[model samples]
Target: MRKLGVKAAAAAVILASPAAAEMEYSFYIGSQSAPHSVLSGTIDGTAGTAIDSTVAWEGRSTAPPPYYGMRGVYWRESGWGYGLEFTHAKAYASDADRASLGFDSLEFTDGHNIITANIHRRWKNQWWNGRLTPFVTAGVGVAMPHVDIQHGGGAHTFGYQLTGPAARLGAGVSMAITDRMSAFTEYQFTYSDNKIDLDSGGTLETSLITNALNFGISYSF
Candidate 1:
C-alpha cells in the first residue's frame, strides 16, 4: 500500500510539470508580388496582315491583394524547429498588353500552389518579459503553377499547368499573447524555375523571383 501511494504521488508531480517542447499551428494572410512584366512575341508582315512576335514588356501585371497560407511547426526548448507550409497566389495580364499581343483582349492568369519544408532558429532574448521571439528560416520545396490564357469575348482559352522546384529565405518575429497562443509577422523571398508550353507553338520559360509579407496568429500545444 505504501509503494502504491508513492507511485501515485510521483505521477501527480510529473503531470504538474511544464512541457519542454511544443507543436504549433499557424495561419496568416499577406501580400505577394511578382514585379516583372512579361513580353509578347514579335510581329511580321505589314498593314492588316502583320504578325506579332514576342516583345519585351515592362511593369507589374498582377492584381494588388494579400495571399493567405497555413503552417505546422514542431519546436523544442533549445531554439531549433522545423515546419511544413502551404501557400498560394494569383497573377493576371494587363489589358493594354493584351491588345499589344494582337488580340482583342488576350489575358492570362497564373495560379500557384506550393508546399515546403523549412528549418528555423529562434533567438531567446525577450524584449517585453519573454513575449517576443525572433527567427530566421530557409527551405526548398516544389510548386505547381497553373496558367490560364483566354480571349476577352469568349473566343478561345488555353491552360498550361506545370510543376517545378523552388527555394526560399525568410525572417520573422513572434509575440506571445498567452501560454498557448501568439501572433507573428514574416517576410520571405522565393525563387522558382518553371516553364510552360503554349498550345500555339511557343514555350515560356519562367525563372521567377517574388517577395512576400505575412501576418497571422499561432496556437501552440
Candidate 2:
C-alpha cells in the first residue's frame, strides 16, 4: 500500500508541474544610430620623450546608417526567457578632421560584430485585451571591432582587431498574429568601450553609445 501511495504522489507531482517549454527564433532589421569616441593621451616620442596631444574622433555619428540583427530564444511558462543575439554595423568618415597638433586630415573607420546573452521578463498574461503583451530585455555581451586610423595624408595608418564588453537595455510590445508567429517593435540603447593596440606601440581607447529602433517577427517551434 505504501509503494502504491508513493507512485500515486509521483504521478500527481508530474501533472502539477509547469507545461512544456517553447523555443522562439526572431529576425529583425532596423537602423542603429552613429557612435562617437574621443582619443587623447601621450605617446612615445624620440629618445624616450612623451608627447601629449588632444584628438577628437567622430565615428558613425558623422553620418548615420542602417543595421540588422537577429536572436534565438527559449521561454518557459514562468514568464522568463533567455536568448542569444547578434548585431553588425559600420562607422566611417568621408572627410578627416584633425584636432591634435602635428597631424593632418585624420580619418577613422570601424566595423563591429557583437554577440550577447539576453534575458527577458514578460507579463504572464496579455495585459491589454488579447494578443498584446509587454516585455523588457537586457543583455551583456562582447564585441569584435575592426579599427582603422589614417593620418599624415594617408601616409600613416594603424589598424587593429579588438574585443570589448558591451551591454543593452530594451522594452517592447509583442502582438500575436497566429498560433505560432508573433511580431514586435522595440527601442534599445547600447554602450561599449574598447582599446585598440597599435603595432607601433601603445593603445587607443574608444567609447561608444548607440540607439536602435527595431521591428521583428518571431516564430515558435
Candidate 3:
C-alpha cells in the first residue's frame, strides 16, 4: 500500500508539470502607427559632418508589405505562460519630410522586424460560457530591419541588418471557438532603438514607438 501511494503521488506530479502543458500557435495581421522622430547621422560625402532632421513617418500598414505577426506559446495550467513572437512592422518617411530633410527616399518598409521572448498571464472567467479569457504579455527582443535609404546622388542602402533592441507590451482577450481554437484581438505597443549602418559609410540613429491593433486566431495542442 505504501509503494502504491508513492507511485500515485509521483504520477500526479508528473501530470502537473509544465511539460504536460498546452502549446499554442497564433497568427495575426495588424495595423501599425508611429510618431515623428529625429533621424541623425553622417551622410557619405559632406566631409563627415553629422546632420539632424526630424522625420514624419507613415504606417502604410495595408500597403504591399503588410504588417503581420506569429507566436508560439506554452501555457501552464496555472494560467502563466511563456512564448516567442515575431512581428513584421514598417515605417516610411513622409514625402514632406523627405523633401525637407533632403533625402530622395528613406524607409524601413520591407520591415522593421522584432523577435521576442515573452511572458504571459491569463485569467479564467465565467464569461461567454466560460470561453472568454483575458491575457497580457510583456517581452524583450531585438530589431532586425531592412534598411532602405537614399540621399541625393548617394549610395542606396537596401538590406537586412541587426539594428538594435526592442521591447513590447500587449493586452487582449481570447474567445474560444472550439476546445483547440480561439480568436483574439489585441493592442500592442513596441519600442525600438535603431542604430543602422548607411551604405554611404556612416550610421543613422533613431528611436521608434509604435502602436498596433491586431486580430488573430490561435490553435492549441
Return whichever of 1 and 2 wins on TM-score: 2
Return the lDDT, model 1, position 136: 88
List model 1 lDDT by residue over 69-127, tens digit each.
78888888888989988766544444555566555533223455566898878885466
Return the TM-score for each candidate structure: 0.71, 0.73, 0.94
Q: 89-178, model 2: which lDDT tens digit per residue?
A: 555432432433444433334455567899988884476567887888899997666555533343344553645898878898888889
Predicted structure with the largest TM-score when compared to the true one: 3
How many clashes in each candidate? 11, 0, 0
lDDT sort, best first:
3, 2, 1
User: Distance (Å) between predicted and true CA of 199, model 2?
Assistant: 3.8
* Global fold similarity of model 1 (TM-score): 0.71
- Provide the global lDDT of candidate 3 against the true structure: 0.89
Candidate 2 regions off by >4 Å? 1-19, 41-66, 93-110, 124-128, 153-160
**What lDDT does the true structure give each of the candidates?**
0.65, 0.65, 0.89
Worst 10 residues of 1 by lDDT: 41-50
Among the numbered candidates, top lDDT falls to 3
Better of 2 and 3 by TM-score: 3
Please provide, for model 3 over 1-221, each residue's C-alpha lDDT reduced to its tens digit, 9 standing for 90 to 100. Answer: 99999999999998778566899999999889978898888876446647698888888899988999999999988889999999999999999998877778889988889889999999866477788999999999999988888887688899999999999999999999988899999999989999988889878899987899999999999
